[model samples]
Target: MYSISFLIGFSLLAGFAVAASPDVETRSRRVRLSASVIALASVLLALFHLASGPEFFALSPGVLHVLDWMFTIGGVGLALVLLYFCRRIVAREWYIPVLVVLQTGLMLSAEFAEVTPEVAHPFYIDSFTVLMTLIVGVVGGLICIHAIRYMQDYHAHEKTVPNRQAAFYFMLFLFLASMFGIVFSNHLLWLFFFWEVTTLCSFWLIAYSGTDEAVRNGFRALGLNLIGGVSFAAAIAWLTFGPGLHTWELDQLIAAGSAMALIPAVLIAVAGLAKSAQLPFSSWLLGAMVAPTPVSALLHSSTMVKAGVFLLVKLSPVFYDTYAGLLLSLIGGVTFLVTSLVAVNQRNAKLVLAYSTIANLGLIVMCAGVGTAGAMWAAILLILFHAVAKALMFLAVGTTEHLIGSRDIEDMEGLVYRRPAMAAMMLVGILGMFLAPFGMLLSKYTSFQAFLSMDVMLGDGLMLATILAFGSAPTLFFWSKWMGKLVAMPRRLPPGTDPIPRDEAIALVSLTLITYVACALFPLADKVFVIPYTDYLGALGLIPVVAASIPWDNIAIMSLMLAGLFLMPLAFWLRPPRHAEVSGYLSGANVSGSASYRGAMGVERVVESRGYYLSGFIREDIMMRYGMLGAGVLIVVMVGGVAL
Candidate 1:
C-alpha cells in the first residue's frame, strides 16, 4: 500500500504534466479523474496502516547499492543545475549558488565514502505519517479541484501569460507526490531528494506568470530554499559519517541517542526552520503572493511549509530540554512575536495571511522546542486547524479579488452586502484564525498551556510564554479589523448575484466545514490520535497526555461561540436586507442614511473609520531588516549551543 501510494502520486503527476498541451476539455477530464484516484489511493493508504507489523521493506543489497549510486550522482547533477541558474540570473548574489555547490560536494563526499549501506526499509508507516498523507491527499485534492475553475478566470484576466494549464496542474500533482515521499521516506538521501524536488516545483509554480517580478521572486524562493537543502544534506553527511549513526533510518538514529547526533539534529532543524519560513527566512512566502492563490493555499497552508515544522517536531526527542531545544524555542518565539507585530501593519490580504502563517509556524516551532507531550499535542492540532482555515482564507480572498479586483482589506468593506456568500466564507476563515470556538485559537491556547508547563529551570519556559502572549494580542487586533470591514453594512445595495464558480464553491465550503468539524472533534482527536502517538513513542515524560482532565466548560463556551459566529453570517445571507435601512447613529438628516449627513450649510459630509497600521512604529523595511538581523545573530547562538 505504501509503495502503491507513491505510484499513485507519480502517475497523476506525470499524467497531469503531459496533459497540459491538450485541449481544455481533455485536461479537465484528466485532472478530475486524477484527483479522484489520488484521493482514493490516500484513503486506501490509511486503511493499509490500520493493520501492520511495523514492517520495513527495501530492495536487496545489490539493488540498494545501485540505487545509492543513482541518487548521489543525480542529486549532485541537480544541485549543479540549481547553482548555474542562481548565478546566471543574479550574478551579484553569486555566492549563494557557490555556497550550495560546496555544501553539495561535501555532502556527496561524506555519503559516498560510507560503507555501501543497505536501504533499510526505504518506506514505513506511523500514525503521524498517515495524518500527513491524509492532509496531502484530501487538502491537495480539493485545491486541484478548485484550480480547474480558478485557472480559467486567471487566464481570462491574464492574457499575456501563456496558458500553461497542463504544466501548472502537473506541478501541483508532482508536489503532492513529493509530499508523500517526504512524509514516508525513512532513508535520508531519499528524503532530501524529495525535499529538493519540492523546491524545484515551488520555483516553477511561482515563476509561472513569467513577469519580471514573478521570475525574480521565484528565484528568491529557490535561492533561500536551496540554502535549506544544503543544510539538510549536511545533516545527512554528518549522520552517515559521524560515530554510531551509519544508517539512514530515523528510528535507528533516535534509538541510538548519541550525543554526537545533536549537531546533525541542529543541521536538520536549520533546514526545518528555513522550510517552515520561521524567522529571518519568511520573505520568500510573502513574495509568493504574486502567484495564483491556489499555489499560496498549497504552499502556505498544507504541504510545503508544514514539512519544515514536521521535521522539527519529529526531532523534538533529540533536543527537548537540552541546549539545542532551548535555542530552537528562542527562534520560534521571537519569530512569532515579530511577525505578528508586522502583520498588524499590512493592508494586502494575502500578505496578512503570509505573515500570519509565519507567526503560527513560529508558535509551532516554539512548541516543538518545548518538547513535551502537551506541546506536541498542541503542535499537531495547530497544523491541522491551520491547514483548513488558511486554505479557506486564501481561496476566499482569491474569489473576492476576482469579484472586486482588489485584495486590500479596506476594499472588503461591506462585502457582506455585495458578495454575501463569499463574505460569509471569508468571515468564517477570519473567525477561525483569531476568534474562539475555532481550532487555531484553541491550538494557540493549548500551546500557551504547554509553554507554561515547561520546566522554568531551562530559562526558556517563561521567556517563550511571554513572547506568545504579546504575539497573540496583535494577531487578535489585525484579524478583527479585517473581519469588521467584511461584515460592515452599506446603506446602498449593489445589484448582483454571488459569482463564485461551482468548483471554487466546493473547495471553499469543504475547507470551512472542515474547520468546524475539526473543532467539534478536538477532544476525541486528542484521545485517539495524541494519546496513542505518545504511548507509541514511549512516556518520554515530556508532559502529561491526560485527556480526561480537559475542561468541559471551555468547550461549552467555544461551542456556543462557533454556532453563533459561523451561523450569524448564514442567517444574514439567508435573509439579506431587502431595504437599505439605518444601522448606526448619525444623529441628523442624512442624504442616503449612511455615514454621510447634511450639515448646517446643506452640504453633505462623511465619516471615515480607517484601520490602524502602526506605520510609524512598525514599517516593513524597519521590521524586516531588524527581524533578519536579530534572528541571524540568535541563529549563530543556537548553532553554538548545539556544538557545546
Candidate 2:
C-alpha cells in the first residue's frame, strides 16, 4: 500500500538516474516503466481515497513553518533561474527581475502573516484529484514515452540545438512530479509553489532550441505566466489579510463561497485565465509552437494550459452570477470564434493544432463561467477527450513531418495510400475532435445544452452560444478538408518507405485504441467519474444537481451517427481490389505515371491545388489585433467593476 505521493518521488529520483546515464533508448524504457508504476498507484490512490474525507498526515506544526519558508525561498530561486535563462534581454528589460522580486516580496509577506492554519492537512485526494492524477500519469506519461522516439528523430535533423538529452528528460519528468503535487496540494501557497514549478519547466523547454525565435518566445511565455504568479501571490495576500478569512485551503474557501466576493476571487480567476491562455493572453501559446512537438503536445494537452482551466473550474462556484463571471464567458466566447477563424488561415499543421487547442480551451472556460453542474460536467469531459486526441494528433504530425519533411496539411495529401496506418490513426484523432459519439463533440453538445438551458438571448449564455455556432462551422470545414486530403491518393499507389519508428508506433496505436474504447464506454465513464464529481459540487452547495434523466434516444442516434462517420470511410478503405482507380481531374490529357498534364506547347506541367487559407479575407494579424483590443477592454471593465 504505497502512497502515490511516495511513488511520484520515486519516479523523480529514477528520472534523475536516467538523465545521468545519458542514453536515449534506456531512458525511454525507464520512463515507461516509471509510468507503469504511476498508473498502478493511480488506481490504488483512487481505491483508498474514495469518499474518505480529509485524512490528516503525521507532521509537526514546526515542520509546516519550515515548509512555508522553503516555498518563500523557492519563489526567489525561481526568479533567479528565470533571470539566468532570459539574461540576454535583462539589460534592455530591467523590469523583468524587478517584477519577479516584487512577486517574491508579496509571497514572503503572505508567508509570515499566515499563521499555521487550524487545518494542517498538506493534501487531499478527492475524486477530481484522482482524475487529474490519472491524466497526468497516463496521458502525460504517454507523451513522455512518445518523446523517446520523437526526440531521437528530432535530433537527427535538429543540429542547431546542441544535444541536451539529459536536460530534456529531467525537465519533463520533473514537470510530471510537479503536476502530481499541484493536483493534491490543499494549501494555496503550496499549490502556488508547484504551479510556479510548471511555469519554469515550460520556459526551459520552449527555449530548448536556443534559436532567436525560440528564446524570444520563451521570454514571452515567462513574462506572461509570471504575471499569473504575481496575481496568484496577491490572491494569497488578500485572503490572508482581507476581512475575517483565516485559511488558504481551497476547500475552506469553497465552504465559505457564500462569503467570498469579487476582489480576491477575481484575482485568482485572472491568474487562471493567463495560465489557460484565454483571449488577450493567447499569443504565448501561439508562440509556443516554436518549441518541439512533444513540448507543444505536453503543454497544450495534458499539463500547463490544462492547469489553468482546472483552477477556473474549481472556482466556478464563486463565479456563478457576478460581472467577473460574465466577463470570463465573453473572453472565452470571443477567443473561440477568433481562433477558429485563424486556424483556417494557416497551412502549418502544428499551428492548426495550436489554434484548435486555444479554441477548445476557450470552450472549457465558457463552460466553467456558465457555472452549472451540466456545464462543469461538459468541461471535465472536454479535458479528458482533448488530452488524448490532441496528443495523438501532435504525435501523428511529428511522425509525418519527420518522414516527409513537411508539416503543411496539403503535403499530407495521398497519406492514406502512402502511410495507411498513420493516415488511419490521424483520422481517428480528427474524427474524435469534431464528429459524433467521440468524447469531444459529445462534450460540446452537452455544453451547448447547458448554454441553451440558461437564459437564452438574455444573458451571457446566449452570447456564448452564438459564438459556439459560428465557431463550429469553420471547424467542420477545416477538418473535412484535411480528412479529404489524407485519403485522396489514387487507389493503386504504393506505400512510402519511411516506417513510423517502433516506439512512436506503439504510442500512436495505443492512443487510437483508447480513443475508440473511451467513445464506446463514455456512458459508463459519465456514470462513474463525471456524475460523482458533479454530485460532490452539489453537496458543497456550489451548484445545483443536474437532472439525472439519461438521454437514451439521443445517445442511440449519436451512436448511429458515429458508426456512419467511422464506417463509411473505412468501407472505402477496404475496397482496394474492387475500387476503380481514377486520376484527379486534369481537364485534358494527363501524364500516365504522375500528377502532370500536357501543356498547350507540349511541355509537361505539374498541376496542384492547395486548401484555401482565405489569407486576404480572414487574416490572422487583423483578427489578433481586434481580438486583443476587445479582450483588453473587457479585462479593464472587469478590474473597474471589481474596484467599484
Candidate 3:
C-alpha cells in the first residue's frame, strides 16, 4: 500500500512536470495535478487501511535486507545530489527532478520492505501513519499548487534581475519529497535524515529571494535547526548503543519503553520542540515569514512544523508515562500560552499567522505530552484541520496582500469590499480556528479534558497548565477582532477597483471547500479514523479513554453558524441609516469620516487604531534570550532527571 502510494505520488509529479513545463504554466499545472493526486491517494490509502486486516502483506528476509540498503543508499544519493545541485544549478529547476526521484525511490523501498511481519519489519504503516501520509500527500500537494500562482505573482511584483525560478521549483519539490519521507519512514535514523532534508530545503526556500533579510532569516532557521539535527543524531546514536534498543524501528522503540529509554527520548523531544518552533526557538519560524506566502503556508501548516509534532506523536507511548512527559507537557503548555498572548499584539498579518501557527503547534506538542487516547486523538484532528484552515488563511492573506499592496492588518481593514471571495474564505478560516464543530476547537476541548485527567505531575504543575489553558480564550478574541476588521464593509469604493486573480480565487475556493467538508464531516472522521486510533492507544495503556456522552448537540452549533451567515447579509440589506449622527467623546467636533474628531489646531484627525505588537513587552531580542535560556535549562533538567 505504501509503495503504491509513493508510486502514485511520483507519477503525479511526473504529470505535473509534463503538463506545466516552462515556469509559470508548469507551476499551475503542477499544483492542480499534485493536489488532485495526493487527495485521491490519501482517501484510498485510508480506506484501504480501515478495510483490510493487519496481515495484508508478506515479506522475506532477502527483501528486508535489500530494502534497507536501498533506503540507506538512496538517502545518501539524495543528499549528494542536493549538495551537487545546490552548487551547480544556476536556474535551480533541475533539483526538483533529482529530489523527487531519490525520495520516491527511498520511500517506496522502505514501504515495500516493511510490509512483511517477519524479518523484524522495520517500517510498518498503521492508522496514524496513514493519517500523516494523507496529510503530506493532500495538504502538501495543495500548497505546491498554490505556490504556482504565488511564485508567478511574487516574481512579477519584484521584477528581479536574474530569475531563479528553476531553483525555486526544484527546492519546492525536494521539500515535498522530504516531507513525505519524514512521515513514512519507520527507522529513526531514516526519519532523522528526512528531517534534516526538510530543514535544509526550508533554509534554501526561505532564502529564495536572496535579499539580505531573506538570507539572514534563512541562516537563522538553519542555525536553530542544526541544533535540532545535532540532538537527533545524538538520540540515534544512543538508541543504537542502548541495551534492548536493538532496532531503530518506531514500534520497537515504543514497545521497549523503559526508564532507560528516557535519555534518547528527552533528546528527541528537544529536537521536536526546536523543529516545532516552541518558544525561545520560535524566532526561526517567525523569521520564515520572510519567505514567500506559499512557503510560509507550507511551513506553518503542512510540512515543516508538522514534522516535529509527528515525531512527538510517533514516540508518545515511549515517553508519556515518564517524568519526561511531564516536562514536555509543561513546556508545550507554556509555549502555547505565551505565543497566544504574543499573537494578540502582532499587526503584521503574516506575523500574526506565524504566531498562531506556533501556538497551535504548542497545543499539539502539549497533547502529545498529555499522551492520553483523547489527547492523541485531539492532536491528530488538530493536525488535519489546522493544516486545511491555516493553509487557506495564509493563501487568502497572500492574495489579499497581492491585491492591496500591503500585508498590514490596518491596511486590510474592510477588505471584504475589495476581495469578497478571499475575505469570506478568511472569515471561515478564522472561525475554524475559534468556533465549535471545527477540528481545532474540538481538539482543544479534548486536550483540556486529557490534561485535567492526567496525574503524572501534581498540584502546581496541573494548576498552572489548567490556568494557561483556560486563559487561551482571550487569544480567540484577537483572532475574532482581526477577522471582523478584515470582513467589515467599507463605506464606499471605486467600482471594480480591485479584481481577484483567477488562479488565486481557485486556490482559495478549493481550500475553503476542503475546510468546510472537514468541519461538517468531523463526526464521520471520528468514527472512521480517530476512534480506532484512540482505541489502539488505549489498548497500549498509553492513555485512558473517558466515556462521557454529551447530549447530541450539533443543532445549536450549526444553527449559530447559519444565523451568523444569514444575519450578515440581512444587516447589510437594512443599511441602517447611512447618515446617522454619531458623536465623539470630550465634545469634539465631527470630522469628515465616521468616528473621527477635530484635534488641537481645529484640523480634522482620523482616529488611527492599531493593535499592539508589544515589542517592548515581547521584544524579539528579549524573548529569544529568555526563551532559549528557559528551554536550555529545561533540557538540562530533563536530561539529569532521566539520568537519575
| Whole-model lDDT values for every prediction | 0.77, 0.78, 0.69
- The true-structure Cα RMSD of candidate 1 reads 2.8
Q: By TM-score, who's the top model here?
A: 2
Winning model by lDDT: 2
Q: List the residue pairs that clash in candidate 3.
A: 20-26, 31-145, 91-167, 92-166, 92-167, 93-166, 93-167, 96-170
Model 3 misses residue 488 by how many Å? Answer: 3.5
Model 3 lowest lDDT segment of ten: 572-581
What are the C-alpha RMSDs, in order, of all predicted structures? 2.8, 2.6, 5.8
Candidate 2 all-Cα RMSD: 2.6
| Lowest-sum lDDT 10-residue window in model 2 | 572-581
Worst 10 residues of 1 by lDDT: 540-549
Per-candidate count of clashing residue pairs (backbone under 3 Å): 1, 0, 8
C-alpha TM-score for every candidate: 0.92, 0.94, 0.85
- What lDDT tens digits, residue by residue, belong to model 3 across residues 303-402? 8999899888867776665677877876777677777776777788899889888888888888787666777888889888888888988998898888
Error of 3 at 175 (Å): 2.2
lDDT of 3 at 6: 71
Write candidate 1's Cα lDDT for 565-593 as tens digits.
77876765677644365745665567666
